[model samples]
Target: MSDPSLVLHRIPETLVEALMMSLRKSKVEELQLRTSVLKPKSKVVVPSMRKLLTTEQSNKASKSVGRKLPVPSNQIRDIVQHHCSNKLTKGAVEAIEVSFEKFFKYLCRDVMAICLHAGKKIVTQADIELVMKRQRFIKDNKSLQILIEQNFPLEYRQLFIPVASSVTLKQRKKN
Candidate 1:
């Protein structure tokens, strides 16, 4: 009791091996059964990642989302594989697709709210930008505009971009 010694109370070899296997599978900081159970300094997220990672997408309560996404699955696969050294697991790819779908749904939902607020039935890029501006901690409307201009595919950039215009100043001479 004074020493907190449990060496006399030995664990079965199989249990010890299984615990080590689970720890290794989790890919956290190296732990050994030297004294007592050691906890990692920071959490290893494979332990916390929800197994119910969505494979499909859901729409907002107001509108039905399109089943087909603009970005092809192959493109997602390619991107994931490129980052993962030419390897993509089926679960990981599907999770990525679902995450994108969910992100898109929320983005559209906010944009739709803006349209509804303005008493307009059409959702526009302007509405999307407005929502982003309103949602951001600090107003940086042009930042998002610039991001779209830079990252959007060249073919589509001209169609819906909000070109940020520079304000000009004139000096008046006073007597």
Candidate 2:
């Protein structure tokens, strides 16, 4: 068993530099730590930037640090910090919240359409292009009368049909 106080000697400088850079980077802020070691020339205690480790770094550093690697980021951990003093403001949050419902609905509809057309229920980065293309096609071809409503079904066109129908209604009823 390795002693907690006895850190491994003769650690590689690149690994140390990488460790320092990774742990000190904005992405891994919470795990930041400070350690001091004497430089051979300076003979003074200098703070070591190589104090913490990323999951990858920690895994490699584990062989030397003699402990389990740190956990990687997940949805919960990735939530952007809501520091009041930061540039982000309540107005921005409110704006996002206001559109959140519409955003999710559009996202779900797009994903479902892609799945229905492609026969793949699982969404991937590749599906993003198809979704964007479909949206652009609908937006660009608004003035063009529905030539083949058969290909694009009613359920998906419910939002667009009203606008198109209003422009050229066969029976002129009321002002």
Candidate 3:
């Protein structure tokens, strides 16, 4: 964090500079989290942005803090404070919220699609894991993955599935 007092240049004097400054302020983040597990490779969407946004269920997400979004900003801020940085800025929190929302949306979409295609009304962790295999996950450490997977309490998971695979698969006969 740069000290406000170590002054080098003056504030935005022109309109263009002012707009740029405003954008920069809105995008301040200590860490750059991946927005979506399945992000578009191209910056410009071939299909209109409006159509993509509307079709992707982005409207289901809320931007305001304290709202019941898919991934709450407060929870993300807490996670960042606990694991990554203690002195993160508000902009960083907003960024996390945005990324989490996208990631969660993609996750739900993929999981639901898989379940529906399989003629199942209920979605299971197996569906989620299958989708994850096809999606692009963030660059988190293996230790972090292990920690999260095994961080469950004894009561939540009492002598059940093995660490290797949680879901039980049925065997299919091949002619």
| Better by TM-score, candidate 3 or 2 | 3
By the TM-score metric, which is better: model 1 or model 3? Answer: 3
Model 3, 27-51: lDDT tens digits are 5421122323345352422221132
Across 25-116, the per-residue lDDT of candidate 1 in tens digits comes to 65543322321255535344333432222334322321344346667888657545544665677767767888888878887888887788
Q: Candidate 2 — which residues are off by over 4 angstroms? A: 1-88, 137-175
lDDT order, best first, reads: 1, 3, 2
The 10-residue segment of model 2 with minimum total lDDT is 67-76
Cα lDDT tens digits, model 2, 10-88, are: 3465677776676557433332322223333433333445455569887566435422212222211223232233554
Clashing pairs in 1: none
Clashing pairs in 2: none
TM-score of each: 0.40, 0.26, 0.42
Against the unseen true structure, what C-alpha lDDT does each candidate score?
0.58, 0.49, 0.55
Q: Please give the lDDT score at residue 150 for candidate 1.
A: 52
* RMSD in angstroms between candidate 1 and the native structure over all alpha carbons: 17.8
Could you tell me the lDDT of residue 162 within candidate 1?
A: 31
